[model samples]
Target: MSGKVVDDRDQLLGEAVGLRQAGKREEARERLVALSARFPQDAEIAYQTAWVHDTLGLEAEAVPYYERALAGSGLSDDDRRGALLGLGSTYRVLGRYEEAVATLGDAAARFPEDGALKTFLAMALYNTGRAHDAMEILLTLLAATSKAPEIAGYRPAIEEYAKDLDATV
Candidate 1:
């Protein structure tokens, strides 16, 4: 790609993210759409476009961008985690529970240090009627992060999950 197109894409993406953060969801989606059209190979733009669609409750529109981002190479670990989690969350929200479970399970395996992914996977498992497995995952995550700051951050939800798990099992 030319330097000019790259620069334009970067500027558009930055503006789109700022617009989304400022509660201008429609404007952000427009900018993201334009960016996606202009730079189809840009993974970050595709991912952000997917996010804008997600925030607007347009899961169907987001799926294409997410798939494009997933097909791209050279993503950082955080971006990979974000894409995986976003896809999983979207699938979960759309009632594709099995897909969410499988995707989040893969993400949890890849990002074992990410407490949030583990919690998300646990939720997917629980919601998919695998409460026992969810409980086991939560217990394992808590045990593993017992001394980390992440444990404290996830403690409240994790504890509530534990109670629900116990009730289910």
Candidate 2:
């Protein structure tokens, strides 16, 4: 990436993402701020900036930017999905369980193939006292991912939740 032209928007985004991954959050944020200034119409920059804020535990500051990203005219399906999930997570962290459930449920319907979406929805459901629904979703995920070796990564939590749900029933 060193020889690549940083002047390009996507390259800048890549660099920012790389910086974020390298734990240079301040630098990443600076890059995003510069990108936001340079391209006010670029929803991706706003979205990434909001994500950085969210990672820094600034949900209140992130919400408007996520809203802006959602409203931005030319976003692709992936960006739309990211914005939806980010907004839902922010709402969840803010104790808006109903909104989180509604937002994540909509995202799950829109992107049924996204395992992370299902997991997130399950978490929200479980936290909101809908453990049965959470268990059902987790069971479905386990079935779908049975062939993958890393299913074990999520199994314990799923089993614990399932037991809790069973006790509730």
Candidate 3:
């Protein structure tokens, strides 16, 4: 692409993202739809399109965009992380629990300290009938990330329980 085309693409993408941030999601979605069609192979456009669709409750529509963004070589590390979480969470909401687990499991493995990924993964695990595993992840997340004074006092116990939720007192 020419520098002019690249500059235009960035400008348009920035406007679409601004719309999304300003709570003009419908407008953002419309702009992104056009942008995606215009720049089919653009990773940032694909990611933004998926994000807009996901925000608009269009999870099915978001999947291909997310997939394309991930497959693209140009996606930045941060956007790649967001795309992973977005796609996995979208799968969960769409009742594709197995896919959700697989996607999120991989994402959590990639970004081990991301609480949000683990939380969503736990939700998917519960959906797929792995309640014990789900609870373990949630409990561990709560123990490790909670800032409440109440939780602070119980962090040690919570950590222990997270390791073995089935253990008897």
Task: Judging by TM-score against the true structure, name the best candidate.
Answer: 3
lDDT agreement with native, every candidate: 0.85, 0.82, 0.94
lDDT of 3 at 124: 99
Which ranking of candidates, highest lDDT first? 3, 1, 2
Could you estimate the TM-score for every candidate?
Answer: 0.82, 0.74, 0.95
Q: Point out where model 2 deviates above 4 Å.
A: 1-12, 148-169
Tens digits of per-residue lDDT, candidate 2, 1-169, equal 2344335888888999889889888788788878877777778888988888787788987887787787787678998899889998898888888888998999999999998888888888988998889888888788567766577676766566555555653
- Pairwise lDDT winner, candidates 1 and 2: 1
RMSD for each of the candidates: 5.0, 5.9, 1.1
* Top candidate (lDDT): 3
Candidate 3 lDDT, 1-169, residue by residue in tens: 9999989999999999999999999999999999999999988899999999999899999999999999897988788889999999999999999999999999999999899999999999999999999999998899888899999899999989988888998
How many clashes (backbone N, Cα, C below 3 Å) per candidate? 0, 0, 0
Clashing pairs in 3: none
Residues 8-46, candidate 1: write the lDDT tens digits. 767878889999999999999998998889878888888
Worst 10 residues of 3 by lDDT: 72-81
